[model samples]
Target chain A: MTYRIDNLQYANWSEKIFRQMREGGVDAVHVTISYHENFRETVLNFEQWNRWFEQFPDLIFHGQWGSDVRKARETGRTAIFFGFQNPSPIEDDIDLVEILHKLGARFMQLTYNNQSLLATGCYEADDSGITRMGKQVIKEMNRVGLVIDMSHSADRSTIEAAEISERPITITHANLHSWQPALRNKRDDVVRAVTENGGMMGFSMYPHHLKDKSNCTVESFCEMIARAAETFGAEHFGLGSDLCQDQPDSIVEWMRVGRWSKEIDYGEGSAAAPGFPPQPDWFKDNRDFGNIENGLRKIGFSESETAGIMGNNWLRFYDENFGPQQI
Target chain B: MTYRIDNLQYANWSEKIFRQMREGGVDAVHVTISYHENFRETVLNFEQWNRWFEQFPDLIFHGQWGSDVRKARETGRTAIFFGFQNPSPIEDDIDLVEILHKLGARFMQLTYNNQSLLATGCYEADDSGITRMGKQVIKEMNRVGLVIDMSHSADRSTIEAAEISERPITITHANLHSWQPALRNKRDDVVRAVTENGGMMGFSMYPHHLKDKSNCTVESFCEMIARAAETFGAEHFGLGSDLCQDQPDSIVEWMRVGRWSKEIDYGEGSAAAPGFPPQPDWFKDNRDFGNIENGLRKIGFSESETAGIMGNNWLRFYDENFGPQQI
Candidate 1:
């Protein structure tokens, strides 16, 4: 029952390397859509998205990027859906929402830690609770099937979105503030709001992402995850594990700076956060929770709970909200 | 003993109007420097401000904008100095704190009504709580001399600003929310915070702005004023009628829309407000309590309290916060 899912991927990922996903035990890749169409030429166009489907065949892609996942499905590409780390690409265009959703965007984080035209991002200098546009976006998202993600947004903006969003939101990737206390982490209210609203919460394994990465272990991640599950009731929670298995340090730097766009940085000289111990398998070792099974097992999740933590809970969520179109 | 003062206006307006004021029976004006302005404006924009001295020679202008007021006073303009609103308008630009303090802009309002880059505005969609930016704004405003204004901001933003602000903020132009549940009005906590913080509260003659304007008479205005004064200590309350005279219906509609460029509304479309029939001079009728003077009488206020409500209370506030600078 513990269906595994890794919620995101970067632009430079390769088809040949991900062939082991079947062995990696990941059931679906919840891929985010990029505003930039030229994603490393590999994921450059619909052709790459189609190629991934042809190559993996059984692999399911939950798209956040702009891909006709269903169209790909018609061409035998497994369900590649769309997601957005920030709602900016949608801009003020709510109608584009239906077009994107129909084109297959499944998840959206309201902001990316800075002020957008819609709301203050989590990392922004000012945390204006939410903007008029943010409110409108949430309502529209509910009408469409775009899931709200609070992973990188500020607590105030996230909480506001949670209260306003009719459909439960999905925290695509976050840690517990109690465990990590990083800006990227979620507060108890945020998790409770999301889960209480019948949404999903995900835990990432960026050690630098955890509080004391110096002492961070899988146990810490689990403790954070389990605590939130206990607080909001376990059924509403799951894992995203923002597992950037092979993303380079440059990409990491790009992520850190690019998310905010504003040049004002307190950590101008500091390296990218929660840096990994230089393991031989640096990419897989530092970024992911673990290499598949060992990751959850080391995190001390019971098999059934681990199942829920992996993809089962997400599958159930997808089924309840958008799966089967039974509604 | 009933001294009249306007709690809001730019710094030099006093000198310009002071000559006319002695004729009109006006004593002083609570001159506000916009919190959003740069320090250079306060410090360098002295020539025009100095012109006020020659014009109104005897009229006193309370400097609520920032530090430039001190310099203005030093150069011979009598200043009752303080910051009028909490938000520095510099927002997360905390560095501007000392710079503006050096310029003399002190008083601030936590927010306007919708959420700002710093805090929630009075008319926000939800009254969640003090945001991180709001909390920071309060601390900085207090550290400096920014007075927090809660007249047109959100309830939660007001509450948070009150609790968090080091110095007490005044409800400079608010009616009792108990009388009418408009966003511009304040609650009992407002009374407590201002009084407790040793700040002042003021009543407004904004009949059109009151919650139940249709039912509003001078009696109702008096009731609201008295309730707030009593709830807080009378000593901590004052009169800031927020009276804007000589504007056209278009301007009224502009205020109604709550925006300079955008025209949204202040809520409650149909209500009896002070209008042309009784007009500005309408309150002159009832000597016991019907007239503005009578309204004070109906409240059973002593001459001192009457004077304070009439305007002296605000005078005391300005004189207290900014007067010590006078050699």
Candidate 2:
């Protein structure tokens, strides 16, 4: 049973997208529920999702465990797993790690794009690694089955997270810097540190992380995945997409600045293009997943390996890591 | 088996207090875990209690249901039930009613001596009764089994809450206005509205609510209880000591001021006595519960009625109200 999953997406969600997921045969998606919202604000986000689940029960449902993926497949619906791009949802409270997990958040990044209370973000000049609270939060997150995601963290912090987490840590959405040279992309050593600790990496489809930005070809994307698989094993790779479908440029501004700056931060975009860049034509939305599948096959991935890259690896990882660790 | 439950207390809790509860044969306590804290700060308070529960497992455990009282009695430990003295923990979000309940909150007052989003507090000059959000929150609270508490609310709002709530609400800690006429005390009509709707009132031992402040006699307190029982029935009454044992004046100041006021508005105290008033000699601490038991017995109350007032009545209320409502 090949299960298609996108481990990261922050779409301006609608029924159209839900239908597109079904059209794409995507069984589950780990969706960004919050970026810089505090605990109360994040809860309001969860409440919004609850309303969505109720309003569109036949199209989507809340996904808490791997079994929910199987259930979604059986029911012909998409399972929406919750995640955060920053530790801001937990605020400064380490105990909120468990609380947020109980509220159905599966992934939490220690930093977004700046120095947080827990760790240094990739944009920071100095890489201070993890702070005292970061270590404590990591242990609590491990205990409570909230996966540590260092997708936007500094090198030292990401490496330290991979080592400090008793459970495997993930870089849920990023490519290799060796391939794209993007600041948001992971370095070879960071990827190796995570993958060697049995963690997974989800290749990003966001244009900034690609070789030629919006003009990057499907062949090139497939070749990049092939290279990552060759280096880090296919089981450690999956799709994240980072799809921001239908979201306006103001959303991008919010993502980049997020009350952290009074002035705008361009992030990966330049001053002239300070907004979400267009996706490569071939991978436009959920329905374009098939294009990548064919690209993988044309690039000579075996059927099982393609299945693993598509979703099976993440499903397995979810099964193992989304619950309290066995004593 | 008679259960000894204090339905309200906000003590400066310590090992000493827990030991004193055991010495007094107290099985359960609905303790105020927050006064004006927002959701995240309230969670920090919960975490503090969690640490205490861990540190003194033999002395007390987290109580979520009436059965915990029985468990406490059998194990010779006290069960600490969590409550909030204000609606601030929910912070204008109706969904947090269930979230806080899942986190073990059993009681939440609609207001705390100032106008709130939910209702008018005693100190507020205008009584607008239940707000639009308050009505929705009441239904959600009923569905989730977080009891509506109107202890610090004004007359119109308290009456409105009793009418709006499908489940029985509570005046967790206050005395009768007819007995002492304090601003915080419930009027006879307010008490009738709650009691007639099957709600319970926990008689307070706070000096300001007593007949003669700190010098009020045990006999007078017991006689007042007798009069209340005669008027509202014994089953609707229990003890809520309002015990601020060992709390410093600063804590009392915080309780009264919170972050709402720039100026000191000494609630239940005058400018000359802008702090917690001294408890009557007869009821100074948890260890003094025995004195109330003796006074109740000496006031010509039957054993069953005395037992009910001591704790059995609250035990019954907990059994009926501490979980999700029946479909």
Worst 10 residues of 1 chain B by lDDT: B281-290
Superposed model 2: Cα runs more than 4 Å off: B1-327
Q: Could you give candidate 2's per-residue lDDT for residues A221-251 as a string of tens digits?
A: 9999999999989999999999999999999
lDDT for position A39 in model 1: 19
**Interface RMSD, every prediction, one decimal place:** 7.6, 17.6
- List candidate 1 segments past 4 Å from native: A1-65, A68-134, A140-147, A152-169, A175-203, A208-327, B8-23, B27-88, B98-104, B115-128, B153-160, B178-183, B209-232, B244-266, B270-304, B322-327
The weakest ten consecutive residues by lDDT in model 2 chain B span B257-266
Per-residue lDDT for B1-327 in model 1, tens only? Answer: 465554553322433344444443444445444433333444544335545545554555535432433333354443444443434235335556655656555456655544554566665565545654455556665665556677767766666676776666777767677888765777776667667877777666555456455346776677766776666767776655554444344444433332212323434343453222123444321111225656777679888877776666766666555422222
For all candidates listed, what's the TM-score of chain B alone? 0.72, 0.99
lDDT tens digits, residues B91-128, model 2?
Answer: 64566888899999999999888656567778765565
lDDT of 1: 0.56
Clashing pairs for model 2 are none
Error of 1 at B119 (Å): 5.5
Highest lDDT model number: 2
